[model samples]
Target: MSTYMAFVYGILYLLFTTFTFVFEDAYGFTQSNVGLVYIGIGVGMLLGLAVLGSASDKIAIGMAKSHNNGVIKPEYRLPALVPGGFFVPVGLFLYGWAAEKHVQWAVPLLGTLLVGIGIIVSFMCVQTYLVDAFTVHAASAIAANTVLRSVFGAVLPLAGLKMYSKLGLGWGNSLLGFLALAMCVVPFFFVRYGERIRTNPRFQVKL
Candidate 1:
């Protein structure tokens, strides 16, 4: 589920990182101005990480107190993913649609803010969840996920111009919106039945 959320968040990161050029061109903004928009995303992300990443641990640990189960249930880590999942598509759609329509520049700016918040929240959840769920192997797990995602992160921006050109912002972004919707289902699957899959001996112990 954490990896799934990362995939969704990763795509959004790609969307914004690649397509900010759209704002720069559409609004005829200066590079500094455009850089400020990117900076807003960076600032928003840092704020989220500072707050939510630490808070979620408190939340999980607090919830575990009631169960008296010495064990921290992976389910406790899920609440954070919920809002993060909801916002990614909404932000992307707003950003793309507003830009395409030539709405006030702030419309897209707001969308960027939402995208920033969503990505931060989702990432923190995934990182914290993986740390909790895997324990001894957590560093390896994070490293592995980081390597794959970093590769995607590096390549996705290069494709953005071609994709946006071919599809136009509306459809190109709509495609991403659809993908986000698909990603939203991942948490539900994991929350509903992921434990069974993880605990199955055949699945858990492997070469």
Candidate 2:
């Protein structure tokens, strides 16, 4: 789940940063006003936090209470991930095509809003799942997650200017959206088989 989250977030980070370019080139926003447009994403993130802040724990505790063994597994935290998975790709497609067609700025901003919601919800669930799964090793697991995401964040964007240039925002981000769509399966896989991975000797990490 951590590995998959890293890859997914890398793409999102790419989109987030690249939006500045989108605003400038596509919408003719000046440097001063570009920052204002980002409020849409901020609003979305806040909404995500508000919804998931209590809901994630409630879901986890409820599942644990209902479990035959009454023990909570980290997997319970991931069901919320399903919503985030959908938000991200759909948001990307909206943001991309909206920008390509030069729709209303609010349309693109709305797309960013959904992306923001997805980002925060996903981030929270991933971190919580890591903490519940690894306990003492949570920090290490997070460090690994951070490192991989950073690598992707750094490397993927280097291609942004070229990618957007060649593929255009519509197809460039759509390509990423499709990749993200495929990756949406990751959370379900974890929820279903996380224990098997944790228990299997070959899958066990050094930590």
Q: Which candidate tops TM-score? A: 2
Note the clash tally of each candidate. Answer: 0, 0
**Over the full model, what C-alpha lDDT does candidate 2 score relative to the true structure?**
0.84
Candidate 1 structure quality by residue, lDDT tens digits, 14-115: 676554577677888887777666765666577667778778878778877876465677767877677667677887888889888889888877777676
Off by over 4 Å in 2: 203-207
Q: What is the lDDT of residue 182 in candidate 1?
A: 79
TM-score for each of the candidates = 0.86, 0.93
Could you tell me how far off, in angstroms, the CA of residue 130 lies in candidate 1 after the best superposition?
1.2
Q: How do the residues 1-207 of candidate 2 rate in per-residue lDDT, one tens digit apiece?
A: 766777767876687667788899889999999989879778988999999997988888888899836788988999999867778888889999999999989998898888888888888988888888888888998999899888887888777779888999899879988987888898888888987887888866683
* Model 1 poorest ten-residue lDDT run: 1-10
